[model samples]
Target: MEGAVISDEQVDLLLADTLEQYGYDFTGYSRASLKRRILRLFTLDKALSFAEFRYRINNDSSYFKRFVEQITVNVTEMFRDPMFFKTLREEVLPKLGTYPFIRVWVAGCSTGEEAYSIAIILKELNLLEKSLIYATDINPAVLDRAAQSIFALSYMKQYSENYILSGGTKEFSGYYTANYSLAKFNDDLKKKIIFSTHNLVSDRSFNEFQLILCRNVLIYFDRELQHKVFGLFDDSLEELGYLALGTKETINFSPFLKKYKRLGTEKIWRKIQK
Candidate 1:
């Protein structure tokens, strides 16, 4: 553990070599976030020093996959931020109705919570039939879980309250049925969503979208990465489409600050004409 101190030079060297060799770009991520995750590698595994861990990960595909999952920032909950969903319900959805068909890209959707939340809202608006949701994440494990749309039963009570606070119309129970320890989400809701592997740092844009929801995921990245990904979102979204971020995030500091119209403090921003 003593030799595992991940210095800035080590971080730089590791990240640069990683991108050059594997095309996984951690170089553009926040130094603090990078430090924390790297430190965890040392603390969790007694066999590894900074250089040793880098050497091991460079050769081991399984180790690198674990690193990808660890670094991708998968923390999320169903209707986690009530106001964001409330804003979507009250403001964003109504304006979005003009489009006969809507395609939403939920970038960095973790464990299916946010995607399910959006699906619930679209269902309430009678918009699910016309909607196609592409939910993506760097963590394949989380994406697999998301695809299953089954969550632990223990978390449902909290999520039910969140659903209610986010302006749910029917009994929150109407969305999912309980088995003893798991809640399998509605099959109808599952049909509208397509969950896949997407690396915001390395992957190229797949399609232009009517809305892009990239929330707390960016908080783990440095400003350069943030701006680069923002540009990606800018290119991916259709003209005047919406970009919904996490409650603490904003485009004000990014290059797209002027390119987007901030709908409100609820973290909904409308991408306008560039």
Candidate 2:
């Protein structure tokens, strides 16, 4: 027979107590979802019971990094939800391009897929050299991986399909080369991006952006924290700049509702002209 699972109450104790000790603030996360992820964490680390896991998380940096990875393992792919990129290239980029120079922030850019996706589009639009991309993620481990600009070979097929759907005309293979099991991206495409560790949980707004893409990241945060992040984005976006959220995410329910309009059906929004 298999081992029994941990209880949700125990999982709460694990998360809440660990948060109290580390000051990482999981208190704002959705309780039910957090419990689910913690249960999965326990399953993945079957050698460690909840108590032992909590102990390691509090006392060891290495354990904490692994814990963060478990908690924030989101799915991503290049040109994902291609209509979003279509909306970007059609409705958003034109306005952004009107500026002499552009600054775009890709908040929570996991594993560099989204960042690279954006760079490819900008390159196609001839804005690559004139624009600055700040691709930030809370996980330093993911940041390091993003900096390398290599992706698993298995993902190439899916990325190529997405690129095509998003109006790509070039051979996707032309942008990368195979090295053993990985596909290394072209050096020219990597030059315009800056990958850094930025905690959306604790970090303050550091710069203004003409376009901000914080896709799918808000689903992990509670409503209050989502609004807080929206405020940060609103402040960071310039007059008439663009904002793109995840497929299901939106600014409609928040105070930003009146201050933005959907750029298209594609999850892109522009700041109100006021």
Candidate 3:
């Protein structure tokens, strides 16, 4: 309904039903952000009230998948916040070189662009051979797209610009070949990356990592959930390992605040030695 006033109780009921029926947890997400997304979903059909939408969510298995997709934000890009990548190249990668092998975890990697960007940087720095990247997200749809490694050809211009700004030494086009409407990234880059589905809200850390990039994904979460995920990251990182967050996120208020030391001006943090 165009003018339907969905109550807070309705949203809570919907989230609770989603968790109970589908086992997907959205209870820890920021209320306002979740509300906006849910309203946006409701606007997709003006005929359905919030209760009807909630019923559809509980009744239709297929629509449940779409509902999950709707609420989860997938906005991301290659070398997003170019300067952050630049710092990663200049400051972080060099330190990681001391390790014989490196493991990088890109959490909530939507549509694969972030993973591809990291692979490219590692390749440029001659570290790809020794690196294993685990790129994960909760959305199966985006994970498939990421595994395909084919982005819209139109996005190349912006991705290329981001690449250059992120200290790309060679022509950005060298990394991918363009078909008529899609740009296929090099298979070599994809080989070093593993794409999987990981639900940050409910899943535990699978492996220790030398670097964890959970960029831009935490902003959707409220403080309690943010701390939970931060704890997961704390456990996931090896001693002196790096943790990168979104530009707007910080470890300041986190319980693990003292466990990490901020690095330079980037949103990067280094795990403090015990």
Candidate 4:
């Protein structure tokens, strides 16, 4: 099945139907990215026609769940971008530790790897007891897996290397117990973390935070949508709070740019003005 089989009109129709019926808005998502994922799902599911694909997504609740999961990108790993975590450990977390209670929002935290990574940092810094991490994603299926505190054991070697590169001094294996093919992370690492569903497209800011990490998420949104989400993050972040983005993302063109000061060469910016 060629990707061209799914026409632009068909993609638009599917997005509209998804938003109307499920309240999951992908309308602001990058058309090329969305179309690509939709086409992939269409092929993988072996749908005979666009009509069958649309019908399954709209009428079957289970299929709709699968559609949401498939469309939304969920690729993530612990301590992704080691230097980012290294900066957090050496600079960001220290400043945040001064606060009586630290509140961190890991938006678009797919399957919880990054959330756990943050928890590990807080724990090592002795700030875990004083901190709360809200890990959220638009897809509930991923959120469910995140809440389980389990990840593929096969990825540990890479994750452990990332941890070491990120200035971790302890044995990375101490963080989780291997159970056959899966590794169950320590329950303590999740004690201060909360996993929930949040749609950046339509959800309102639920709380103000000292740090908000929405890395690699906005790249999937159109410029207009990216600005809207930046506004959402702006409203949810307290004065002097920090916002982190993926290496490919930046706030240079955002209306909020002047209000923030970039931190070093990393894609982190500290809010300098309320």
RMSD of each: 1.7, 1.9, 1.2, 1.0
Index of the highest-lDDT prediction: 4
Residue-wise C-alpha lDDT for candidate 3, range 1-274, written one tens digit per residue: 5566777898999988988997889999989989988888888766356667888899998888788788899999899999999999999988998899999999999898999999999998899999999999998888998999899999999999999998887999998999999899999999999999999999999999999999889999999999999999999999999999999999999989888899999999999874
**How far off is residue 272 in model 4, in Å?**
0.9
Residue lDDT tens for model 1, 1-274 = 6645668888788788778777887777788878888778667877545667888778887888777777667788999889889899889887887899989999999898999999999999999999999999878888988999899999989999999899986888888889999999999999999999888988888998888999998887888888899999998989889999876777889978887888867788897785
Model 2, residue 38: C-alpha shift (Å): 1.4
TM match of model 4 to true structure: 0.98
Best by TM-score: 4
- Per-residue error for 236 in candidate 3, Å, reads 0.3
- State the lDDT of candidate 2 residue by residue for 93-130, as single tens digits: 87788799989999999899999998888888998889
Error in Å for residue 90 of model 4: 0.6
Per-residue error (Å), model 1, residue 96: 1.3
CA-RMSD of model 1:
1.7
Instruction: Write out the backbone clash pairs for model 1.
Output: 30-222
Off by over 4 Å in 2: 1-4, 17-21
List the candidates' TM-scores in order: 0.94, 0.93, 0.97, 0.98
Evaluate residue 6 in candidate 1 and report its C-alpha lDDT on the 0 to 100 scale. Answer: 68
* Model 4, residue 243: C-alpha shift (Å): 0.3
